[model samples]
Target: MNHKLLPLKVFLLLALLSLSQMFCGINIQTENPTADPGFMATGIAATLTARAVSITPTVTTEQATQTATQQPTETESQQPVQTEPVIPEAASISVSLDTNCREGPSGDYQKLGYLLPGQTAALIGRNSTSTWWYIENPKKPGQYCWVWGEYATLHGDISAVPLTTPPPPPIPIAG
Candidate 1:
């Protein structure tokens, strides 16, 4: 073979080999001059890693147990939550303008004192008719009065007791 044609023949053989390798599923990834190959590969790897992290819930039982234990300790160290005392509200008291408070339990009971619209009273009993509440006017000392339930709303102080019974009162001294 001629020397000039020998080089041409070798070049043709190499090209054919490259073409056959491509047809046989040989992947030869060549980096483009415009972009860094490493940067592109790293970005693709990072994206795949992020996708894997999202797809899988990586928490183990030990991790969950550790979190559970740590949380209650933090919660216990937190301040005790203050809650309003729950009261079984039964009755309420209100005032009528220029209202009269009686001296005794029944009407024809003398008016011992009077109350104004802003006065406060404590409900003590129910009236005979059940339509009115028997109230002790807190403002008028030692006075029991009556007011209609239709006009009065309920008022009572609610106190929180610890969830246990108190100890019994001490026995009376012997005579």
Candidate 2:
């Protein structure tokens, strides 16, 4: 018998014995060969168990795999890569903080949306003083809203952004 198979055979025998040990145990005794071996009564003896198993030896530290490095062979490479400079898109407002985007150019206007931090909105129009930009509503598509310039940073040209007149407030202002 192979030495490697010896452990497997012992493991199988122990497994079968452990199953029988669940119900009863076996006692080996010497007697007449023909005599009837009477009922060998047994009981579940213990709660905890111990068994020997075969496993690879543990090392104190991780072992690194060794590999042979190959020397690079000479080969011809490709042409110089062509690149284009990225230009910032014109007429946009990026809000530094979460600010209310309203129906028109003032605080009196009903808030239609929010210009959140890291959100950029297209600038199509501005107030006469450029203090408010009439922008595409960040929350509603194709609808327009106005955001205060105080919390917004303008990108590209505002010169060509058309001057927008403020619309009448949706609610009557309290005097």
Candidate 3:
């Protein structure tokens, strides 16, 4: 064919091949234009090698002796991976309305502070009637007091709350 048109056809073929990334050999440029075609493809010819190789590999078949290969006594073993135990969260309580936190479960006890509508406290203990909840004081940090559960929202494991005995009633004093 025409040598002048060959370069343009090759370039168009390369462009089409490059647009479709599937063809791997499109961009490969031969380094030695003077190298022999047959040996150059094998990479050894790229060196313009003369009298490059004379060695040839030959194979022979033979029966192996029983002692030639030994079987392993033990195999690679994997130990069990240890995981951390998941602990359940403690129960909590929230007041629906502003409620009074008292020293004891009853109304007679001295009022400590008020647990507001939006505040939450830990439901530490519960009375036998379940009417009162012992909680971390919402107003006073690091301290605890009892609040009536009538307007309270109980969350988490409520059964996990331990039973507690409330203090005795306050004695009335004459003024």
Candidate 4:
């Protein structure tokens, strides 16, 4: 046998032995036959040898049952209930005239919906300059839009109204 091929053969043998031991749950014993310095001096190639050895796993039946029947502690069993941050209804705005609710702070934005005369909406936010009030649209449930402050009367602290970045307009889907 070529001396160059001896190491590769030894490596493959050791790897196969380890994999078999892991998957079959069998214990293995390995010996390097040419480990002695004099063996190589005598021109003998290095060889790997292995044999099966018995090793019983240490897991006990009582330990296994205890692990399977483990109960959660009181802290683990009870979780803190989560609640949404209450944004106080800071203000409500009533439209003085039929006004357009736009997607953004400016009139240049596309109209999302409308605020009718005498219609009131909850104030959500305002622009940096406080010229716009972002409000929840009464016409569209669960939807918010913006109306010009000039055309509406604010019923609460306009300063307490949080400023918000307006959402982008919905992309028009082309049919």
Best of the candidates, TM-score: 3
Clash list (residue pairs), candidate 1: 91-154, 92-153, 92-154, 92-155
Highest lDDT among the candidates is held by which one? 3
lDDT (10s digit) by residue, model 1, range 1-175: 5674565456556655884775686444544445556666766766777677668665676544322111111111224445555444444455533566654434455565665554556566664445555666655667555554454434543122112221233455689
- Which RMSD values do the candidates have, in order? 40.5, 34.4, 26.4, 30.6
Per-residue lDDT tens digits for candidate 4, residues 47-92, read 2111111242346665554322223222222344555564533587
- Which residue window of length 10 is worst by lDDT in model 4? 45-54
- Ranking the candidates on lDDT from highest down gives 3, 2, 4, 1
lDDT of 2 by residue, 98-148 (tens): 899998988888899998866788898999999999888989989999999
Q: Which regions of candidate 4 deviate over 4 angstroms? A: 1-89, 168-175
Which scores greater on TM-score, model 1 or model 4?
4
Clashing pairs in 2: none
lDDT of 3: 0.72
| Backbone steric clashes in candidate 4, count | 0
Q: Is candidate 2 or candidate 3 better by lDDT?
A: 3
Q: What's model 1's overall lDDT?
A: 0.52
Q: What is the C-alpha lDDT profile of model 3 across 1-175, one tens digit per residue?
A: 9875575466556645774663443453434434444443544443333233223333544964332222233323445555466455568876656899999998989999989865778898999999999988878888889999998877667988999988888998889
Q: For candidate 3, what is the TM-score?
A: 0.58
Worst 10 residues of 1 by lDDT: 67-76
lDDT of the structure predicted as candidate 4: 0.67
The all-Cα superposition gives candidate 1 an RMSD in Å to the true structure of: 40.5
Q: Count residue pairs with overlapping backbones in model 1.
A: 4
